[model samples]
Target: TLAPSAAPAASASPAPSTTASPAPTQATDPAAAAAAPPASVVAQYTALTCAPSDVRRSAASTDKAQDWIAACDRDGTTKYLLMPASVVGTDVKTASAGLQGGGGTTSINTGQWVVNVEFTGSGQGKFTRLTEQTIGKQVAIVLDGVVQSAPQTNERIAGTAQISGSFNQSDAEDLSNVLRYGALPLAFERSQAESISPTLGRDSLHGGLLAGGIGLLLVIAYSFLYYRAMGIVVVASLVVSGGIIYASVVLLGSAIGFTLTLAGIAGLIVSIGVTADSFVVYFERIKDEVQAGRTVRVAADRAWPAARRTMLAADTVSFLAAAVLYVLSIGSVRGFAFTLGLSTLSDVLIMFIFTRPLVALLVRRRLFSVSRFSGLSPKMIGGRAAAVPVATTRARLAKRPTPAGQKRES
Candidate 1:
């Protein structure tokens, strides 16, 4: 269990060190001290304050004789700092003996970011007592020989200690990470950076575009072979949709710096099926009307309402799925979802603006009236011939015929 002894007097000296090299008594220049560096990663908190000039004068004193250690401020708010030797009584290793989980978050009261550190229930009394003794003094939290912070103790704290400062979100998070995972063993040094070749990226882009192109060709081939003369409308609608999507991608890339990744291309490729399904619904509905013995012109108009509802339902499902994925995911997956949702919306617009109106105008042409030319022919779609109701009239039979029959109804 983690425990803390009572605070020693402010003037008391530190215990004898057992390490190979003794800690420096003073750092006259922060830059020079940073350059030479120490071999220790110890974190210390002290409650005494010393003037920068005073610490410099005591640099040559022995460990026992020196009463102050000079440190640099972490955030550069202060260039030099000093603290008494005795109050470095509790290092991080000792203070964190009963550390529980903690994290960085914003304060609800002030809306300022802060780090909340929690200690186990057993360490609650020890922390409370430590804060009480250090009240009204600055607690210098020194790490890697730099003063990370020197927060003043206003009152006694209990189980949880909130470290609040002029911290932005990122700063608070970084400090919390350091607290959770202790200091690094080695210091950072300058190193060379390597650049990656773009050959693989080019190959991947080529493969993705090739695959999408193949898929588009297959959809177009099937539409022509199945929909007959009506296939022209599908091809026309696809051309227009592709144009719109290309323009939008270019505009978005320029405006928002959107990059069309491989996943995004896949989304556009999948949208081929979505656009195909829309026209297929309309075409099949027309065939259904024709099967019920309606002319092509009449069927085109009559089939619209049902086909419209079905297409709306299908696109609605696709758009909702894309929206959910985009919201819940990150990185490439979000790019995929964004493109898919965009394509779905474009599909709906093309159906209303291009496909539907084109069919309406085409069905009025004399060429569409011919069963052999129009894909909605009765024979092709198995439309039944319209039945004609025959009227019957009462008639009188000849007398000779009645005699021959010998039993004619009067």
Candidate 2:
């Protein structure tokens, strides 16, 4: 019981009411009771509505909300995440396996995300832990903030790791550059895009071919005129070297999508001069030895070391130039540098393999030693030294019998 002005306490005893609602024990007005509930009760009710589990359940009903939650949950701690099956496709396993093995290294440094990856001892342990922790989760290899790979781990990995996707040589090289050097090593930015007409490229190619053909003709003519019979060997060596280079180009084009751009063609054209220079060096050295009174075979042998040194020196300069150009230049200039470097290497190979051997074989023959047709013949080489006479003075005098009287007086 309470005074009239004071609020009545809540009744301990449960009681039935005329209305269907629970009986109100307080002495407050029915309207006032309906208008407000106790603060504690209201707080409890609000908290139930805002529980973490309930919010998640509500979010699960909408696709966008679910995605938001999923993304938010990824803190790089989870080993793997589910991605669209279509994005990963069937080749995912194979590629992922390849990534587990170490691949070869390269020099081109684009610097996107090159990491020094190894499977040796400590590396193996780290990779194994990474694979275990990230199992069935996505580990993204990001380059320049773009996801280069978001590979889902199917199993724990151990030992060496290789990064594999649908990568071209350039892509692999670029990635390797990144892993080896770092993201900003190259510092490349898209400068500008200008449309190049194929018409100009075609015209340049045509002119280049024409010039190459004329140069080839001049070399062939000079070889035949100067080297005579031995010139055939020189021509043959050139043909073989050309065939090898052409086949290599075609194979590289097919296998690696290496394009024969105009600049590349120019490099090949320049290589022709390098190759010719090698031949000239060897030929001149041999002729010099022959002029120094050595037999043809001996001259060929004695001249080789000096000629080889000269050829190597010349090719070294060309190779160095090509390498520098490749390192310094970009775009089409790189193609030119690559081709020039390849040709210089081929020149060295041809000098050692075909040219030297063919000359050695040719000089070994009797006809080559004796005939004027052979450019290496001692008599034919500069006409400087006369051939040694076989007949003796006594034999000549006996044949003449110049005087029986002169003999008797003697």
**Best-matching candidate per lDDT:** 1
- What local lDDT score does residue 173 receive in model 2, on the 0 to 100 scale? 61
lDDT of 1 by residue, 17-60 (tens): 11010111221222332343222311221422334543343333
What's the distance in Å from true for residue 300, model 2?
1.0
Model 2, 1-410: lDDT tens per residue? 00001111122221111100000111123233234444543443234332345334433422210111111111221211111111111111211111212243444433322222343354345345545554444444322222233434456655444444444556546544433333322334579989989698789889988888888889889988998887787789889889888988999999999998888988998888898898888888888888877788998899999989999999999999999999999999999999999899888988888888888888888867778888877788767564554665553433455575576434
TM-score of each: 0.56, 0.47
lDDT of each: 0.61, 0.55
| Candidate 1: stretches off by over 4 Å | 1-91, 94-182, 185-195, 383-410
- Candidate 2 is scored at a TM of 0.47
**Residue 179, model 2: Cα distance from true site in angstroms:** 33
Question: Residue 105 lDDT in model 2?
Answer: 40
